[model samples]
Target chain A: MADAVIAAIPPGRHARLIVPRLLQRGEDFTARLLIQHPMETGFRRDDTGKVLPANVIENVVLLFNDELVFRGRVLNALSANPSLSVQLTAQKSGTLSAHWRDQMGNVGSISTEVRVAGA
Target chain B: MPKHAQRRTLLGAVAAAPWWWAAFVGTASAQSSTAGSDALDERVRAAVLVRGGLSLDIPVIVETGTSVPIVLFADPSQLRPGVRVTRLGIIAPKNPRPVALDMELGALMSQARIATNIRLGASQSVTGVALLSDGTVWQQSIAVVLTGSACYDGT
Candidate 1:
């Protein structure tokens, strides 16, 4: 993973969402997401001996077809390059979207479509 | 004293040592567990918490503390029928912030199974708590040993 390249990307562009493209109604499936971040804790110092400010994702929300499904509040205790997985039931064919905001006021979002058959 | 009498005294003392050790260590751990739960209670704002409804899956021994993968599962058998889990949280009592991750599960969730990674400052027991729609709270803790300390020193 190139840290420089990831940093250069605009906020929310570094987010990755992985979900099954096809699904059967009423079946349980897992949706995984990863957001690239340094997750600074403010206790760390840079090479020049200056203390680094804490910068981490503060809020994360996941929605399916505009219906809220999950929301998360992350603290500095989470590891860098935070990733999360949750089990969701296939209801109707719709969009699965993830949005997050960092401590520094940077926001990012990503979405994927899942088709549910027999719905 | 007779030789047999002296031998009997030595054997009795040896047999009692384990019980003594257990009593001493048991009290220490019990106190720590209480403190851990108290911290969690404050974070979740719940008065009473029932243990054993949730399970935490993590390595007993981790080579590094930077990224420790953990999975939390809600036991349906332990929960009341028709009561859904509304929230799930991970608490690291020894870390700077006790609440590592707090998540709200909506109606779309079929089950409460969540996976994530966390940072530990040292070897300590981490707690996982779940809140049910019926206003009941459940929690479970797991001890982890970290050979390499993380999050304490400046990054």
Candidate 2:
């Protein structure tokens, strides 16, 4: 009866995933994914001086046609909306799935398809 | 000695004698709970940053925390055609923890320009790194000062 509310992670904006609509095989492919999250390092405090909970998507997994490929872990050094780019062999056309989970049980998912058939 | 304990001991040590070790096992692991953070530094260096390349150090040390700036400019002549920088990250040697930032730089559409805020854990030398079209890594470092820490309180 209620829609799922996607609240801000805290310090982070929110999560976003980007990728090319089509990629040519035999050439380097760039896959981009951005995550908008509070990415709290569990270090800062609120106006009331409360140590915010450490909430960040610590792990990211990329699946090409259900095959594990690119994965990343968020560290304290990353900016607000974390981004990822990886070089993948454009061998075949398939579905690209990206999943990220934070320490606070928050999850983000994105998927894209590839057309590696010639140009 | 128990069977499991004896076998485990033998596997852990070359001669069953502990010389020394860190809590997290490897140097990177010990420095930061996250693995693959240290090697990411060396990898990015080999992939993008180079000499002849202009290095830009992002200077912003706030407790609120954001990705610091560190950019590299390489001669387009040196880059292979259609080679886009897939990701850029920052590496620190003395931050008491690994600080890594990742971003998808639109290579095909835009010129090489990566400028953004980065999260700093502490005062230390931060290296900017990038990954190019061929999976090669390139990086350059800049020293920064931190009034407060973001990772753990080593101050």
Candidate 3:
């Protein structure tokens, strides 16, 4: 039986990070990336008598042909998983990069090499 | 004032700093709740700034918090040469802690998409706060409903 890895983020809870690679033709490609960030509502508390700190992933970016494409910031009002679907124009495939940044100045960047066999 | 008085003043100043901050946070939270029914305070909100364009909230309707999926529309191509979404935050009135999760947006393009999981507290309104490079702020909000739902996560 083939093995499958499941990446799931708890409901109402935020994610830590996510990286996705989009592959199309031999020379063209699209990279879909995302991170898990709990849209902290700043309400609940732990065992201690103090309130818990808020944490969530916010920013995102997509690169194609070493150029920039989709870009936007995530707000506190968003739900759990930041579902993003961007359109990337592929030309002379070099490398497609997907990057995600959170509120705490943390960043996660992943890249996929492009290989176009057919002209 | 006498030397002893000066010392006492210094001690008082040092001692009441956290208290003042706490008080300020409390009052601000209270005021925000009062001023805008759904508005959270700056302290509780963990207010952060972003670079270039701000990433406000991602206004949308959520059925539950367990498997929440968010969507955005800002054109990443318009962003300057080097910029990234650094942080994301969300807060609600019913949940225990105001924060849900935090992560890093590594060195990548501005046009990217993502999806994740989340835990919810009853049916309440949620907010999304995304921070960017160079210290700027963007935000989004959404309302969630939990019909016939019970808090059963025994973790």
Cα TM-score per model: 0.79, 0.53, 0.40
Considering only N, C-alpha and C atoms within 3 Å, which residue pairs clash in candidate 1? A12-A108, A44-B155
Q: After superposition, how far is residue B23 of candidate 2 from its true place, in Å?
A: 7.9
Q: Is 1 or 2 the stronger prediction by TM-score? A: 1
Off by over 4 Å in 2: A1-14, B1-65, B69-90, B93-96, B99-117, B121-123, B127-140, B144-155
Per-residue lDDT for B1-155 in model 1, tens only? Answer: 99999999988755533222222223324445664645543433433467757999999899888899999889878777788888788877777766677787898877798888888888998888777788676778899988876765634
DockQ by candidate, in order: 0.35, 0.15, 0.13
> For all the models shown, what interface RMSD does each have?
5.6, 7.6, 8.1
Q: What interface root-mean-square deviation (Å) does model 1 yield?
A: 5.6
Which scores higher on lDDT, 1 or 2?
1
Least accurate stretch of 10 residues (summed lDDT) in model 1 chain B? B18-27
State, as a TM-score between 0 and 1, how close model 3 is to the true structure: 0.40
lDDT minimum window of 10 residues, candidate 3 chain B: B16-25
CA lDDT, every model vs. true structure: 0.77, 0.56, 0.46
Give one digit per residue, the lDDT tens place, for model 1 in A1-119.
Answer: 69997667754458788988789888889999898887887777887878888888888899998887888754457788888898888878889999888888889999998889977
